[model samples]
Target chain A: MMSELHINLSESLKSKPASDALGFGKYFSDHMFIMDYSSEDGWHDARIIPYGPISLDPSAMVLHYGQEVFEGMKAYRTPLGEIAMFRPDMNLKRLNNSCERISIPQVDTEFVLEAIAQLVRIDQEWIPDGEENALYIRPFIIATEAALGVRASKQYMLMVILSPVGAYYPEGIHPVSIYVEEQYVRAVRGGTGEAKTSGNYASGIKAQEIAKTKGFSQVLWLDGKQHKYIEEVGSMNVFFKVNGEILTPALTGSILQGVTRDSVITLLREWGYTVVERVISIEELFEASRQGLLEEAFGTGTAAVISPIGSLSWGDKNTEISGGVTGELSQRLYDSITGIQRGKLADPFNWVYTVK
Target chain B: MMSELHINLSESLKSKPASDALGFGKYFSDHMFIMDYSSEDGWHDARIIPYGPISLDPSAMVLHYGQEVFEGMKAYRTPLGEIAMFRPDMNLKRLNNSCERISIPQVDTEFVLEAIAQLVRIDQEWIPDGEENALYIRPFIIATEAALGVRASKQYMLMVILSPVGAYYPEGIHPVSIYVEEQYVRAVRGGTGEAKTSGNYASGIKAQEIAKTKGFSQVLWLDGKQHKYIEEVGSMNVFFKVNGEILTPALTGSILQGVTRDSVITLLREWGYTVVERVISIEELFEASRQGLLEEAFGTGTAAVISPIGSLSWGDKNTEISGGVTGELSQRLYDSITGIQRGKLADPFNWVYTVK
Candidate 1:
């Protein structure tokens, strides 16, 4: 896959911010990766250039029709002074599925990995060197065709950008309040819910904002049809431990198959926990909470490996979980995932792909 | 509304192709309308700039969260050689509603129209003269804030680009084959379905492409829940003539309320026809077709004023309507709408908002 990635260094570089002060996606690296796609050439001309503004036609399909897909991962400066990525294969694999749903051409996984590894190695200085900090990697593809009609674009741009960031929780892994949203559904079966696309994020924003005004950090979405089943929490896949059995929504064509969700499930099963992937309706969850059997609840995503749920408000009722503190299971999962990511713990699953 | 607009003419104007060769949104006019918005200042800095590429940071919210909204309309060359816009206020009003749904800042309707008028006037030569050829107006607002968090953007850019488009159907208005889709859903209740945003269109492309491959010109979308009732056809509001009364899908919070759909309803009622807006299920439509009572079917949209549906394919069953030709009512509706648009007919309804 050595297609000779042309490198163009920036003549003037912006000063890198302190890793502790860096928020998510606030500061970018000096260099980034780009690959172009067209009907004739397909994906070609892979290059690494200075991070700057990307010029697009005003009528680009991505802006008008939203034919875009993205994935989120992280690059960490391991304890051994090596920069490594955590399960980038999972993110890229899911990205292909998202692209397929939108008719975007499938990317060469090996080629993309090669490009990402090279880019991360070149911008190794951006990777934060702390237990709570890492450089976030955002790989995205957008329809670049400047057309107005409702059709698939003949052109696309696959780009990879790196951002230095601190921990997702500024005050460490604390439980955040969640609003149980019944008015809006995140993604329904037979929709783009399982895919990592921009449209899904766009549609869920108003609900998220409303939840914020209600003193919640995120919104817990229900099923689109019945609005009875628990779908996901904010942008992460949710898990609930009721009566010592961990339960998460099954992949019913609508819930995103988060990498962190998959990792947590594997780790829980390995640790002799009964993890079940099935539909847990809202009524069942509320009943469990009422009976004081809801032992633990958390969300899993790339940004926040494990976000504990302290409270959940549904209409007039608000239920406090784990006594408004991080659950024991949630803390263990976050510690193990972050430890494995930073090479402080042994990678039994070989999930960490180190960059030379 | 009387704010002064700053104008920046292009140093080198790109030549436009012939009207016959001009397809939809392929080429742009010499000038375009631009505006900026922020949470602090609201929408301001209205200006007319040369049609060129727009530069956005890689972390723009529109690229990730997809907080974007747009409107589709046309600037017409009236019979008296005046450039007029048909119900543009309606389009802008709907755009505002869409922005509200997605949490984007709304632009002043009057100020936006003023900018559009000034830009269109400056690029007046780009407007086509024939009935089938007119300048397509695309007004869009995108989240320009450079951040990766899944929240509403603090900054936005509103731009209107003009494209000289030929007739929707180069030959003439004719009947199109439609595929009744049950596999994928476009929008669901309490979602972004009613909003004229990019996600709704992005989610529908795969279904649309599959329909095209199945030898159909458009895909008729059923409701997201249960996939029972008819929702829309190829991004257009659908109407069916059952027995003697006209039936269109009621606004169930999942169907886009189209401007053309409204105009058609008004014209039908004024002409003493029963236009009922109610839920039209697939079973009822098929039953009507079997009973020889399904008189006609057509889709109403801005792109194509009236597109007659000739044949409908549902699963293994196929039904031909109106003897596989354009119906009389469809032809009449098309004539009336186009006539009003071009000022060839009386403006008794005052639907067309003529630009001075």
Candidate 2:
């Protein structure tokens, strides 16, 4: 049985930003979902309260040890004037996986899902009505134990905050340039790379800043050991269409199992396309580009859904894929996935969850 | 030149605990040093304030991205009633190195040192008078921008908190058993292993937890790429003496450059011992143990100064080092370092910094 959820609504609401002016994660809704966890109490005091600053001890373990995990999902306003979520259960499950790796106690996924749904319902008007705009939900757990010891924290706080975001590609679907990072590695096997944790993102900031200076938007990471095989594109799982086959790097304990990546694979397989998951080296990819066999490449994630890769630069070599345009496959995947999410297309896979 | 520091003393201070009852990092002092940073003004607002909880926005990047770095040091009460710090300048310099890697802004070391001196001066009474008790200082910088973007935050908080800690070994310095961790990697060559960042420690907790369950006090980490070469012992740097030669892993971009490890190396070299810094494999160590050539091993860090290793368990093989007793070299080094730190021995190398 699900425990009771206490509600404390805010008396005053902040003015919402214009849908067109809403950038990514810039503004938060009026209310947020919060739950407390302790070794003795397990998890309790689930509630929705006014969004505000939190008071933490100076010696909180998360500030010193980085023992935290988070998940990202979106709540869309469907044409039927109802809110929809795309496979939020998968995100909660993945959050638990991250918690296990970070040594945090897990939460009941079903109960948390209900809490998220309730939060979205209370802040339903905050969902943007723009073409690609939606309410971005961020669920995170942080170690709150006020101790300086180097161990798992005894207390934690799990919170969910909502932000209405504008379109990833504000103008249109434009492919982005990617610099293949050689100096730094995102993660190695037996590391926290596969989890939706902050450390992985923190370490990638330097590489990302370097790529930005080089006029590229993101970096294509190679495997940590060999620095040969492709691991990921920025924070997204990468996919390539070579010769008529769809290929992506397998989940080898170093890259995130992206929810959109999984959905794309399922849709492709349902459409009679042969999809293969295995290690693909950068050299082979460049060789394919040289031979005109690399047709198109893109990254998959919840934020962008489908982000086309325009070009890749490794060492002294640069190759533009699909004439530096969004490929047919990339566009089709984006449209189909977004359509299903927004209730425009038939939900063949039953991937949409509606919030009452 | 240093900026003028503002000070706010607490009206009333809390009662102090008995020296013998003080455990490691269990109790904090009265005052703390804090400095704020913004892209617009750099690091400013340096002050000593009453130690208390800090208010942070729910979307502070540090809580979500783990963009933070920290340093650990101790202040000891000398036999002559003077407070002395061992190589504090080194800790401040290393903190800058960690800041650069984590993309946080650097603080003026001299200015920060003055701030620390002031805070320590205000809380000098909190430093315990027990045999092995002293004040432990933790200096950390955390991303404080209330934005949820993936990049580095535009604002940060650099603070130093003091904790009165007891001796690492309460009764005496006894050797500990270690398990060779082969499953989880602490860090890779291109990751944040060398930096004093929270992510490295966060990733190491699971392996340490596993080792503890098997009757080991710590886990000896191996290199990430091959998982064969030695890296670190728990959070400390490892050193081994075999066949009259000292061996420790080189500063190979994947292991922390420990201050204690450096001082020990200098001491050994000055005493006419040949210290080799190179990649030593676990296989070679096991082979030496089989041939009865392995003499002794220990881990070095600020907390313990010197932690002697009694035995090592690798897979199904367990070998006792120096008959599971503290080696003469380990004990001597501990005595020399702690003696110098406490102003009990001659400061030939001029390592101790006395806070006036």
What are the runs in model 1 whose C-alpha is more than 4 Å off? none
lDDT of 1 by residue, A286-353 (tens): 88999999989999998988999999888888899999999999999999999999888999999999
Fraction of true A-B contacts recovered by candidate 2? 0.77
Model 1 per-residue lDDT tens digits across residues B161-255: 99999877665689999999999999999889999999999999999999988789989999988999999999999999889899999998999
- Candidate 2 local Cα displacement, residue A175, angstroms: 0.4
* Candidate 1: residue A6 lDDT (0-100): 84
What residue runs in model 2 are displaced by over 4 Å at the alpha carbon?
A: A1-3, A169-172, B1-3, B169-172
Error of 2 at A101 (Å): 0.6
Docking category of candidate 1: high
Model 1 interface DockQ: 0.88
lDDT of 2 by residue, B1-356 (tens): 44469999999999998998887888899899999999999988888899999999999999999999999999988989998989999999999999999999988998888788778888999888876788999999999998777898999999999999887756557899999999899999999999999999889889989898989999999999999999999999999999989999999999999999999999999998899999999999999999999999999999888999999999999999999999999999999998999899999999999999
| Model 2: colliding residue pairs | none
What is candidate 1's CA lDDT for residue B63?
Answer: 96
**How many angstroms is residue A52 displaced in model 2 relative to the true structure, after the best TM-score fit?**
0.3
